[model samples]
Target chain A: MFTSKQMHLAQVFLKIFFRDRQSIIFNLLFPLIFMGVFVFFGGESEPINLGLVNNSSNTISQEFSELVEEEPLFNVTKGEESELKRQLFLGDQTAIIIIPESFNSIDETAEIKLLLDASQVRQIGSIKEAISKSLLSIERSLRNTQPMFMIKVEDVKSRPQRYVDFLLPGLLAFMLMNLSIAGSGFNIVEYRRRGILKRLFVTPIKPQDFIISIVVSRIVIVLMQLSVVLGLAILLLDIKIVGSLLSLYGMIVIGSFIFLCLGFSFGSIAKTQEAIRPIVTSFTFPQLILSGVFFPINSLPDMIQPIAHILPLSVIATGLRDIANDGVSLLMINLNTLGLFIWIILSFIVATKFFVWKEVAG
Target chain B: MNIIEVKNLLKTYPLPGNKKDSFNAVDGITFNIRLGEVYGILGPNGAGKTTTLEMLEGLKDINGGSALIDGLDVSNNAFKIKEIIGVQLQANEYFESLNLSELLILFGKLYSNEINTKNLLEKVGLLTKESAKPKELSGGQKQRFSIACALVNNPKVLFLDEPTTGLDPQAKRNLWNLVRELNVGGMTIVLTTHNMEEAESLCDRIAIMDKGKLIAEDTPQGLIDEYASEPIQETLKGNLEDVFLALTDHRLRD
Candidate 1:
C-alpha cells in the first residue's frame, strides 16, 4: 500500500545511500570484506591452539599425542603442566590435554583430562569428541582386535552439507540482518535527530508513507548485499543452492523484514545516532554469538541452546539453511515462519507505540 | 477575514517520572491572525512560543479547546491542514548527499505536487548551488533551501519556528528579505522569535506572551505608543524591547 510519492522518496533514499561513501562502506564494502576473509581461510581457518602436557611415557599415549599434533584443526604446543594451565587460563590456548602416567596401562584405569575454557562453548563439545575418537582409534590399534562397531552420518536432505554450504546461508543472513538493523536503525535516529521527521510531519505525508519509503529503500540495499554475498559464495566458494531460487529469496526477504521491524523498535528507543550504536550493537552481538550464525546450535552450552534456538536470527539462519542447503519447501518451515511473524508483529507494535515523530517542546 | 483562529488552546505535559504532577505549557491562549499578514509571537525562552506554533501547525495534540486554519478544525483535520501549510523547522536537515534540487523534488512529491526544482532553487537564489549537497551549503544558503522546501507545496499558510535563530547577521537579513518577498506574494506567515528587532521589522502585528499567557497584542507602532506614553524623567521613550520588558516579569518560570 505505497503511494507514488513514497516510491519517489524511496528513490531519493537510494540515491543518497549510494552516493554517501560511509553508507557505501557499511552497506557494500564491509560485507564483501567479511566474505573475502571468510572465503580465503575457510570456516575452520581459526586453528585451535592447544597445549599437550604429557605425563605418560607409554608408547600408546605418545602415539596418541603425536596423532593429535597431526590434525589440521589443532595447533598443538608442548608445555609443562603449570605453563599450559596458564596459557589455557589466559585464553592464549583453546584447551589443554593431560595424559596421565598410567594412560597406556592395561591393568589400571587411566584418564585423559581435557582442560578447556567453558566460555568456549561452541568448540568444547566438538573438540572433546575429536580427541576421544583419536584416542579410541589408537587403543583399537594397540589391541589389534577385530572391528567392533561403526557409526555413520547420512544427510537426509537432497544436498550434502559441506562447511561452505552451511556457512554461506548464515553469512547471507548475517549480512541482511546487519544491513536492516544497523542500517535502518541509525538512519531513523539520524533523521529524527535532525528534524527531518518533524518537517515531514508538517507536510501532507503520512507516517505510514514515510516508514514504507524507508522499508522499501532498505529492502533494495538488502537485496544488493544478498546478490553480492551469494554470488561470491556460489562462484568462488562453490556453495550450491539446491532449493528453488525464488523460495530462497522469499525466505531472505521475510527474514530481513523481521530485522527491519526490530530496528525500528530500537530506533524509537534511541533518540540520536550516537545513542543508537551501542543499543543496536548490544542487541545484534548476542544474536551473532549465540544464534547459530557462525556455529551449530547444539555445540552451545545447554542453558544457552534453548535461548539461541528461539532467537529470530537463529530461526532465520536455520530456515535459510534448510531451504537452500536442504531443499526444503516453505510449507515445511511453518514454525520458523510463524516465529518470525510473531516477532515482526511484536516489534512493529513496540515501534509504533514509542516512535517519536518530533521532539516535544518544553 | 481571519486565516487562523485559536480558542483556549491548552497543552499539558506530564512531569517526567511523576504522572501526578503535570504542567500546562500552553495555557488557555487565544488569538486570531488576519489573512495576508505576517503574525509574530514574540517571547523569551520557554514562553510556549514553539508549543503554540506546533499546535497551530497540527503537529501536537491540544489538550483542550481548538484551533482552526482556513476554516478547518486543526485537531480533526490535521492531515488536511498539513496539505495547505508549509513549515520550516528550526533545525533544517534533509537526507545527506542530496543536492537542493533533488531534495525539493522529493519533498514536492510527498505533497503529490510536481515542483519545478530548478525554478524554486532560482527563486530562492540557490540556482548555482542546486548541485551542492546540504552539508556543502553555507548557513544562509541552507535557510534559503529550507524556505524553498516549504514553498514546494504551494501552501496557503507558512509557519516558521525560529527561522533565523542560529544565523549570522547577513544570513538573518537575507532570510528576512525572503520572508517579506513570500508574504508579498500572498502567503500568510506565522513566525516565532525572541529577537525584538526581528519581530519589530518583519511582523505587522505582534503577540507578546510570557509564562504561557498573552500579555499584549498590537501593531509594533501601536505597542510603542501605548507602552512608551509613561514619561521617563520628563521624556517619553519606548521600543519593542521596552514594551516586552515592561509587560513580563524578568524571571525564569521553572
Candidate 2:
C-alpha cells in the first residue's frame, strides 16, 4: 500500500525536520534530557526519618526500636520523650514511638503511644502499616504461634517494579504523544500558512497520498526517538525490558498513530498558526499532567482518575509499563489496546471530515 | 477548439452572522479560452477575478454552473484536471530548507511526471541558483521558482494569478517576457492581473470584470478601439487603461 512518492516525500520531510534545530530539540533532545534525569533519580525511594522514645526499663522495648532502626524504610533516632515529641512536632521526624515503663512481658499488656506527623497524609497509611507489622513480628517472638491470625507478604511479579521502571515506560509514551501531536499538528498548520498544501493540491497526487506520506514520515521520526531514548535509558539507567522488543515497538507504532490522527484533527480545526497553539496545548497539556506521566492515575483525585485512565497517553503509558515491567503479553493489555483503537477511529473520522486543503476565505 | 469553457459559473457566500443574507462572489460569469492563447481576467482587487479563476482551477467549488477543461467537467474530475493544469497562486509559498532542484523533483513526483530538474530550472533562469533555498531567493527569483514548480508537471494549461503583483519593473518585464515565451511554446495561458499594462502587453484577449460581472471582453487594441471614446483629454488618445477607467469609473476598490 506504500508508494515511492510517499517514501520520497517522507525522506524530504525527515531532512526538513532534522534541519530545523527547534524541532530536533522538541522532538528528540528534550526527551533525552528527561530520560537522563529520570534514570539518574530512578528506583530510590525516600527514607522516612523516625524518632524513638523509650521510657521503659524492659529490654524488649530497646530491642523493638533497634529492629525498626535496622529496616531500610526508616532512619531511626533515639531521644527523650519530650525531645522526640518536640522534634516530631517540629517536622524533623515522620513519626515518634514511645514505649512506656509498664510494657513488660507476655503475661501483661502495655500501651504504646504513636505520635505521627499529620501534615503528610499520604505517607501515614504506609508508616502505620510498617510499624504495626514490625510490632506483630515482635509480639510473635514473645507469644508462641497462637495461630489466631496469619498474614504472609508476597510479591506479585518475579521482580519488584522500582520507581524508575514505572517512569521509563510512561516517559516513552509521553515522548511518542509529544512527537506525534505537536510534530504533526505544527507541520500541517505551517504548510497551510505557507500555502504549501494549496500548491500540492494542484498536482496529480491525491490527498490520501499526501496523508500517507505524512504518516510514514511521522512513524519514522517516532521510531528514531524511541530507539534513542530507550537506548540511552537502557545503557545509563539500567531499565529492564522484560517484554518482547518487537511487541514494544508494535505498541508504540499503534500508539503514535493514534496521536498522529489526533494531530490531524487539531490541524484541520485550526485555521492559522496562532490558532494552532491553543488547540494543541488544550489537547496535550491535559494529557501530560493528568495522564500519569509522572505518577499513577490512582494518585489523582478519585473523580478524575476514570477520565485520566482513558486518556490515550495514560492507556499507552500504563500498557507499556505492564508489558515492559510486569512482563504482560500484548493480548493481555486489552483495555489499553481497545481504548487506543477507539481513539484511532474517532480521530480519523474527525480529521477526514474537517480537513481543509486550502485557505477558505470568509 | 476552445481549450477551456465556462458556462454561467457562480459562487455565492453567506454573509457572516446572517444565514439568510447571501451574495454572489462570481455572479454567473461566462467566458471561453482558446487554444494557445494568453487570456487575461483584468479587474481591480475584490473584483471576483480570483474567485472565477479558482473555480475553474478546481481550487474553489462552483455554486451554480459548469466549467470544463479539455471537455472534462472540472467539478467531477478535479483530480484529472489538476494533473494537466499548472497554477501559480498569488501567494506562492514552498517548503523551506529544500533547494530549488529538490522542490522541483518533489513536485514532479507529486504529478508522477519524470522531469529533468536542470532543464526545468534553466527554463525559469534559475539553474545557477539550483541549490539555493526558496527563502534565500530574491522576490523575482522566487516568482520564477514558483513558475518552475508549476511547470514541473509539464502542464497543458498554465494559470498565473497576479504573478507579477510584487515584482520590480525589470522583474515584471522579465516575467512578461517569460509568459510570452510560454504562450509561444503553445501552452494555453490564463492569468489574472489588475495591471492594465500587463494585460495589454501580455494577453491576446482580455476579460475585464468589476463587482463580479464581465464589463468588457476583447483583444487589447479591440477594447481600446471600441471603448476608448471620450479620452481624458483630446490630446491623449487613451490606451487600455483609459478603456478600463472609462468602463469601471475612476474609483478606489479598497
Candidate 3:
C-alpha cells in the first residue's frame, strides 16, 4: 500500500513537521494545554446525586429511605417515581433506587430496583456494594437472618457520559481530527497557492502517490500524538487501559484516514491559504464542541444529540472509549466503526472529485 | 528531426460571467521545434505563451488540436511525456522546511532516481548554500534552484516558463550561462521570455505570439532583417527587441 517514493515524502514531511515551530506548537502542545486545563478544573471529586423513590408507605421502607439519605456516598433526592425518572434522563441524577411496597414484609422477597446511567459505569461496583450493605443491615434488624430482599440493577444505555476516563479517549480523537484536517488541508492549500502543486504536476509523480505520501505522514504523526497524549494521561491522570492497546491504535488509524480525506476535500475546494481557515474551522469547531470531546453528547439539546452522534469525531471518540474504557472488542463497536467507514467513503469521493492540480482557466 | 510537433493547438476558457460565452486563450496556434535546439516563445503578458507551454508540458489540456512530444500524444500520454521533459514554472516555492539538498533528493525520489545532491547544486553554482532552505535563497539563487529541480530526472527536453522574469542582471546572466551549459550537454531547451536580449542571446529560433496567435517564427537575425530592417535613430541595425516591437505593435510589458 506504500511505495518507496511515498515513504521518502513521508519522511520529509515528518522532518518539516518537527522543524516547523507553528506546527509543533499546534499539533503537540495545544492538546496538552487542553488536557491540563481539563484536569485542573474537572478533577475534584463531588458527591454522587442519588434519587430515591419511595413506593411503600410502610415504616420500614420509609426508614430505609432515611438511611440512604444519611449515607455520605450519596446526595439523596426524594421525589415521585415519574419525576425522578425524568431527572435521571436529564442527567440530574446519577442513579435511582425504588423501594418496593413489600419492603418490610418477612414472607416475600422485596425486589428493589436500582437504575443507573451507562455513563456511571465506573461507579457501578461501589454504588451496588453500598446499596447491598444498607439492605443487609435492614434485613438483620427484622430478625430474619436469611436474605429477605433482592436488588435488581437496570443500566440505562444512554450516551457514554463524563469524567477523565471518558474525556481522555475523546481528547485523543479530537487531537487526531485537528491534526488531519488542519495539517493536510492547510498544507495542501499552501502548496497550491505557492505553485508547488503545479510544479509537482509537471513531474512524473502520480496523484495517488502524492496522496499516499500525505496519508503516511499523517498516520505517523497521529501515532506519535497518541503516544504522547496517552502516555501522559496514563501517568498523570492514572487512567487504566481496560482494552487491548492494539485495538485502541487500530481505531485511531481508521479515524485518522477518515479525517485526512476530509482535509483533502477541503484543500481541493479552497484556492488560497486564507480561504481554508474558515472552511476547516466550520467543520472542526462544531465537532469539537458537540462530538462529546470534553462533554457527553447527551448534554447537548435533544435534536442536536442525534446529529452529534453521527459526527465523525463522535463516532471515533465512542469507538476509542468503548475499546479503552469498557474493554469492548472491536466487533462490539461495529456500529461506530460502520459510521466511520461511511464517512471514509463520502470524504474520499469528495477529495478525489474536487482535487485540482492547478487553477482552472477562468 | 523535430522532437515536438503541434497542429492548431487551442485552449478555450469560458467568459467569467457567462458560461455560454467563451474565448480562446491559445487560439489555433501551430509551431514545432527541432531536436537539440534552444527555442524561445516571445510575447507580452496574456499572449498565451504560458498556456501553449502548459499544454505541451501536459500541465494544461488541449481543447482543439494535437500536440506530440517525442512521438507521444500530449493529452493521451501526459504522464509518459512528463517522464522525458523537465518544466520550470514562472514562480515556485518548495517545501519550506527542506534545504536545497534535501529538496533535490526529494524531487529525485519522485522520479525514482538517486540524485547526487552536491553535484546538482554545483551545476547551478549553489553548492555552498545547499544547506539553506529555498526561502533563504535570493531571487536568482531561487531561480537557479528551480532549474536544478527541473533537471532532477535528467530529462531530454526542458521547458522553462519565464525563468528569469524577476531576476537581477547578475542572476539573470548566471541563469543564462546555466541554460547554455545544459544545452551544450545535448538537452533540448524550450523557454518563454519577455526579455529581448535573453531571446536573442540564448534562443536559436524565436516565435512571437500576440493575443493567442503566432505572429512570426524565425531565427533572431532573420526576424530582425525581415520585420525590423529599417535602421532606427538610436542604433545602426535593429535587434530582437525592435523585431518584437515591429511584429507585435506593442511593448513586451504592455
Candidate 4:
C-alpha cells in the first residue's frame, strides 16, 4: 500500500524526529521521568496489618484467629484490646477487631467492634467482607449441619494487580497520545507557516501520499516509544505483562491513529504556528486531566466520570489496562474497541475535510 | 512554438468576512511563453504577478479561465503538469532538520527519478555545503539550494517567484548567473519580480501587470521603443523603468 516516495518521505521525517532534540526530550525522556516519579511515590502494595483482640476464651474465637492468620491478604496479630487500639492509633495496624465476651453465648447475638484507621478507609469495604465471610463459615461449622441458605463463590484465576501495573498501561497510552498529537500537529503547522507545504504541493506527490508518509513515520515512532517505555517498566520496575504483546501493540496503533487524525485536523484549521498552540492545548489538556492516565477513572467525581469514560484517551487507557493487567484480548474489550473505531472514523472525517496543502490569503 | 499557453486566466479570492463578495487576483490575463525562453512578469506588490505564475505552475486553482503547459491542461492535469515543472517559491522553504543532499534525494524520490545529489548541488554552487541543513546556510546559499531542490526532476519548465527579493547584491548577481546558465542549458524559465533591472537583463519577453490586469507585454527593447522612447534627463533614451512609470503612471515601488 505504500510507494517508494512515501517510504522515502517517511524516512526523512523519522530522521527529522530523531535529530530534533526538543522532540526527543518531549516524547521519550519526559515519559520515562514521569514513570520514575510514579514508581518512586507509588510504592509496592503491602499486606494489610490487622490487630486481633480475643476476649472470648471459646473454640469459636480461637478458630477465627487461626483462620484470619492463614489469610495472605492480611497480617494478623493477637494482643490485648487496649494495646490493639493503641496500635491502630499509631498506624501500626490497618484495623483492630475485638471479639466480645458474649461471642460464646448460644442465644444472644454477638457484636464485634472493629476499630479502623481513618486514613486507610479505602480498605474498609474489603476488610468487612473478609471478616464476615470468616464468621459465616465458623457459624455453619459450629452448627454441625448443612445451612438452609448457602452462597457458592467461584474464584477466577488472576494475578494481584498493583498500582504500577495500572499506571504502566496508562503511561503508554499517555505517551502515544502526546507523541501523535504534538508531533503531527506542531510539525504540520510549522511546515505551513514556513511554506514547506506549498513547496511540496508544487511537486508531483499527491496530498494523500504526503499524509500517508506522516502516518507511517508516526507509527514507527509509536513503536519506538512502546519499546523504551514498556522495556523500562519491565526491566527496571519488574512489571509483568499478562496479555500478549501483539494485543497491546494493536491497541496502541489504533490509539495513535485517532490522535494523529485529530492532529491533522487541528494542523489544517490553524493558520499559524502560534495559533496552533492554543488549539492543540485545548484538545489535549482536558483529555490529559480527565483520561485517568495517572489515576483510576472511578476516583473522578460521579458527574465527570461519564465524560471521562467516553474520552478517546480514557478508552485507549482502559483498553490497554484490560489487556495488560487482565490478559484480555483485543476483541474481548468490545466497547473500548468500538469507542476507538468511532473516534478513528470521526477524526479521519475531520482531518480530510479540513486538511489544506497550501495556505491561501483570505 | 509556445510551450505554455494561457488564456483569460483568472483567480478570485472571497473577500474576508464576506463569502458573497469576492475580487479577482488575476483578472482575464492572456499570454504565451515560447519554448526554451526566459519570461518575466513585472508589477508592484499585490499586482497578482505571483498569483499569475502560480496558476500557470499548477500550484493554484484556476477560478475562471484556462492554462495549458506542454499540451496538458493545468486545471485538469495538475499532477501531470507538476511532474514536468519545477517551482521555487519566494521564501527559503525546506525542512530544517535535513541537509541539502538529503532534501534533494527526498525530492528526487517524490518525482520517482534517481538523481545525482552532488551534481545538482554543484550546479547551484552549493556543492561544498551539501552536508549542511537549510537553516545553517546563508541567505544566498539557501536560495541556491532551493533552486537545486527544484531541479531534482530535470523539469522542462522552471517557475521562480521573486527568487532574489531579500538578497544582497553579490548573492543577486550569483543567482542571475545561475539562471543564465540554466537557460543556456535549454530550460524554459518563468519568473515574477518587481526589479526592473532583472526583467530587462534576464527576460526575453516581459509582461507588466497592474491591479490584476495585464497592461503591456513585449520584448524589453520593443517596450522601450513603443512607450518610453522620450529622452529623459541625463539619458538619451528611456529604459524599462521609464516604460513602467509611463504605462502605470505610478512608481514600481508604489
Candidate 5:
C-alpha cells in the first residue's frame, strides 16, 4: 500500500518539478552565476589591456618594465608614470602601478607610491595588499641582502588558503539545501493553501503514509537536483569533493527529511501563506545563520553557540562540513546522525498534529 | 442490522482567541441508517449537516455520544470504518495530473489491493474518460467520475457531501438515477445537501436539521405534509424546470 502511495507521490513530485522551470534558474543557477561574476571580473588578471607609451630611455625605467612583465599579476607595458596614472583615472587596468626612473634606487630609503583605483575599494584593497606583499619580498631578497645598507632579510612564507576553494562548495551546498528545504518545503504550506490537505482528509489514507511518501519523493528530487548543481560546480568551477560520497549523500537525505518536516510543521500550523511566510522565514533564517551555511557558527557568542548547536541546521551543516572536509562516514559522526533523526521525529510530531488542512485565510 | 447508528452525537470547537468559550457545531444530534438504503440529511446552510457527515466519516471528532457502523465504533475503529466506506467530497479535486483510472486505482490501493477501474468507470458512465484528468472534465463529468471513485472500494456505505451541487439539471438527474441504482443494488448511502428537490426525488428517508439539531426528519412527502401549507411541488414551484423534469422521467435514459 505504501509503495503504491510512494509511487503516486513520486509522480506528483516529478510532474511539479519538471513543470517549474523558473525555480531551477532562481534556486540553482543564480548562485553559480554570482560566483562566476566574482571570480571572473573581480579576480586577478593580466597586467595591461592598452599600449604603454614609454618616453624614458633610463636603465631604471627599462628594468621596471621588465620586472612588470615578469610578474604574472600584471601584463606590463612601457609608458611614462604620468600617462599610466591618467589611464588609472580613466578606469583602465583596474589600477596602474607606476614606477618612475628613480623607483629602482628607492629600495635604499625612498618609498614608492602605487596608484590605485580609489573608486573600486574592494579591488583596490586586494591589489594594494598583493603589490605591498610582493614589494616586501623584493625588498628583503635583493635590497636587504646587499651590503648597501644595514638591512636584514627575513624569509616569510605565505600560507594562503585557497579562498575560493573553501567557499564555492559551501555556496553550492547552501543553494541545494535551500532549494530542497526552503523552496519545496514551503510547498507543503502551498498545498494546504490550495486545499490539497483538505482533499486528503476526506480519504481513507494514513497520515504517516502520506507524509512518508512525500518525504521519500522529496529526498530523491533534492538529491537529484543537488547532484546536477554539484555537477555544474565541478565542471565549471572544478569543485573537488574530499569527503565520503556516502556520508554526504546520507547527511543530505537525513537533512532534507529534517528540514522538510520543519517545512511540513510550518505548513500544518500556519493559517495562511502570509502567516506561513514569516514563520517559515524565521525558522529558516536561524538555520542559515546558526548552521555555518555562510560563516562558521562557532564564531557566534559563547552563550548562543549551544542554542545554535541544537538546531537541525547546525547538526546537518556540521555533518556536511565533516563529510566534505574530512570524508567522514555515518559511524564517524554518530551524534549528528542521531540529532538529525531526533529533529525529524520532533518536527514530524508537531507537523502531523498541527498541520492545518482547512483553507483558513489570514 | 443498522450499518450506521449514533447516539447523542456532539462536537464542540474552541472559539478562537477565547480560552473559556467553545461553540458546539454538532449539538447532541443522533440518527441511524440501515443497510441497503439511501439516507439523506437536509438543512439550510450552517445547520450542521456537513459537520454531522464529517463526524460520521471520521473526518472530525465527536465531542460526545457514540457512533457505530457495522457494530464497530466510528472513533475507535476509524481505520476499519474507513476501509469499508467510500467518500466523495464537494468539488472532489484530485491531483490535477491524475487521470480517472489512475485516481480510482490509487484510492482502491488505499482501501485494499490492486483494482480494475475499467468496470467501475463503465458503471458510472465515465468509461471513455478513463485517461482524462479531473481538471480536463466538465463539472458534471467530474462529479460522475467522483461517484465512480467513491464506488472503487466496493463500499457498503457511500458518503457524499452535496454530490450534485453546481451540477446542471441533466447531470443532477444522472446522479440521482445513479444513486437510486446503487441503493437498489443494496449499497447504503449517507449524503448531506441543501437541495430539497434532490432529497424528495432520491432519498429513502431524511433527517432535517438546523442550528445543530434535528428539527424535522421523515420521507420528503411526509416532511412537506407536516410543515408545508401546500403540496411539496406547489410550495417551491419552478416555472419550466418541473415540466422539463416531469416530461422526461428523472433518470438519464441515454
Candidate 6:
C-alpha cells in the first residue's frame, strides 16, 4: 500500500504554496509581469530623434530633404558638415545625408553619400540603401514629366511580431527553469534540514520515490503553466504554433526534470537556502544567458559555444524554436537532447553522492 | 516486554577533509524503553539526549551499535518500527496556513489505522479551533495539535522531544495531564527533556545522561530517594494549578 503518507506528502506540497501565495506570485509571476508590462508598453521602439544632415544646397538636396523629412524614420536636419559630425558623435543625429558640392549639370552618376553613427550600423545600412533608391527616383522625376529616372527610398511596412509573442516563449523558458530549480532545491534542503529525510530513513520510502514525487510534481506544474499560457496566446493573438504541441510539451517536461535533478543534487548537500543559493544561481545564470534565453548563442565567444550548446534551456529553446517556427519533431534535435540528458545524468550522480540526509554530523 | 532493545551500537561518519576528525554525537550509548512505561532521558543541551531519542526513533544512523525495537533492528527495519511509534519533533509545524482539521486529515491519511480526528481534536481541547490555521493557534494549541498528529497513526510507542519546554505554567500542566491520559490508555512513551518538573511528574522511569553516557537510571521516586531528598519536597504538589483550574473553567491557552 502506498499509504496516506503519499497523500500527506501531496497535501504538504500544495499546502506550502497555499501558505505563501504572495511569495509564490512574487517569485514565479514577477518575471512574467515585468516581461508583459515592458513588452506591451515599449513595443518595437520608434527610432527616437531621427536626423538627416544634408551638406549641399541644390535642388536635389532640397527635394530629397523634403522627402526624407516626410518619412517617419528621419527628422531631417540641414547642417554644416562639422555640425552633422558633431551631432552624430554626441548621439544627437541619427544619420547625415551629404550631397557632394557638384554642379547640377553632372546628372549621370550622381552618388548619394550618407554619414551615419557607427553604432547604428544595421539601422544605417537599411536606411541608407532606401534613401539612395528614393533619391534616384526623385532626381529622375524632376527632369521629365514622365519621370525619366526616379529613385524613391521605401521603408517596407512589414509589421513585426508583437512584443508579447517575442517575449512569452523566453518568459516560459525562464520560469520553467526557475520554478523547477527553486522547487527541487528548496524542497530537498528542507527535507534534510527539517530532518524529514532523516525521519524517512525510518520508513520504507526510498530516496528515489521522494525525488520522483518532487520532480514529477514540478514537471506537471510547469506543463500546466505552459498549457494555460499557450492556450491564451492562441486565443488572444491568433498565434499558431508550427511544431507538434505534444513534442514541445514533452521536451519542456523533460527539461524541467533536468533542472529538478540539478536542484535536488544541490539541495541534498546544502543544509540551508543561504548556502546553496549562490551555487544555484551559478548554475542558473550561466545556463540562462548562454542558453540563449534572450538572444542567439552564436553571438557569444567561440570558446563558449560548446558549453552553451549543452545547457537544458539551450536545447529546449532550440527545440521550441524548431517546433514553433520550423514545425519539426524534437527527435530531430538529437544532439541537443543527448546533451541535456548528459547534464541530467551528471548532476544526479554528483548530487546523490554528496547528499547527506541531515547534517553531516547528524 | 521491552519495546526498545539496543546493544553496543556504534556510528562514525568520516569528516569532510580530515580522516581523523569524526563526531560521536551519540557515541556508543545503549539503553531500552519498555512497553506501556513513561521513560525519560534528561540531559543538558548537546549531551546527545536528542541524538539518543532520534536513534531510538530510527531517525539517526546507529554508527557502530545495534538498536532494536520489539526485536526488529532499528537501522534495518525502520518502516515496521515507524508504524508502531509516533514522534513529536521539537520544531515541527505546518506551512502556517494549514488549519487544524486539514492537518488532521492529511496526517490521518498517512497510516493504516487512523484516529478519529474529531475525538482527538476534542481530547486536546482544540475542537472549537479545528478550523483555525496553525499560525492562528497559540503556542499551547500548537503543541496540542502536534501531539494530536503524533497519535493519528495509533502508535504503540509515542516519542516526544521537549514537548512542553516553552509552554506557560498552565499549558505545561495541561500537557502533563495529557501525557498521563495517554499512558492510562496503555501507550508506551519515551521523551527527552531538561525540565526536572516534567520529568518528576510524567516519567515513571528517568535516565540522566551526560557526555553521551547514561549516568543514572531509576524510577522518579527511587531517583529522588537516591539523591536523599524526601519524595514530597522534590515533586510537584499539583496545588496552585488545580486551584486555578477550579476557579477558571477556561484552560490557560498560550
lDDT score for residue B10 of model 3: 93
Candidate closer to the true structure by DockQ (higher is better), 4 or 5 = 4
Sort the candidates on lDDT, descending order. 3, 4, 2, 1, 6, 5
Cα shift from native, residue B249, model 1 (Å): 38
Tens digit of lDDT per residue, candidate 1, span B163-253? 8887766667778988999999999999999988899999999999998888899999889889977655753677664565456543311
Give a tens-digit lDDT track for model 2, residues A1-362.
78888888888988887888786766677777776676666547667777888887777776766777777777889999788878878888888878888876667778888888788646688879987777677677656656577778777775766677788888889889888886677788888777787777777777777777788888888888789888988897788999888778888888888888888878877888899999988888899899988888888989999899888888888878878887777776377778867877887887777665644221
Model 2 chain A lowest lDDT segment of ten:
A353-362
Candidate 5: tens digits of C-alpha lDDT, residues B31-74: 88888888999888889988888888777877899999999998
Which pairs clash in model 4?
Answer: none
Which residue runs does candidate 4 get wrong by more than 4 Å? A44-158, A356-362, B234-254
TM per candidate comes to 0.84, 0.83, 0.79, 0.79, 0.78, 0.82
Query: What tens digits encode model 1's per-residue C-alpha lDDT throughout A110-209?
Result: 7878888888546578778876776567666656766688878776764466666777778788888988886568777777777877777888877777
**Cα error, candidate 2, residue B173 (Å):** 1.0
Candidate 3 TM-score versus the reference: 0.79
Interface DockQ of each model: 0.54, 0.46, 0.46, 0.45, 0.31, 0.31
True contacts kept of each: 0.88, 0.73, 0.83, 0.79, 0.31, 0.31
After best superposition, candidate 2 residue B110: deviation in angstroms?
0.9
Candidate 1 chain A lDDT trough over 10 residues, lowest sum:
A353-362
| DockQ score of the complex predicted as candidate 2 | 0.46
lDDT of 3 by residue, B89-163 (tens): 987788888899999998999889999999999998889988998888888888889989999999989999999
RMSD of each: 6.2, 6.2, 9.3, 8.2, 5.9, 5.0
Q: Which stretches of candidate 6 lie over 4 Å from their true place?
A: A1-8, A15-20, A23-45, A52-64, A70-72, A78-92, A95-168, A190-205, A331-333, A340-362, B9-19, B112-115, B229-250
lDDT, each prediction: 0.82, 0.83, 0.85, 0.85, 0.72, 0.72
TM-score of chain B of each: 0.89, 0.90, 0.91, 0.91, 0.91, 0.87
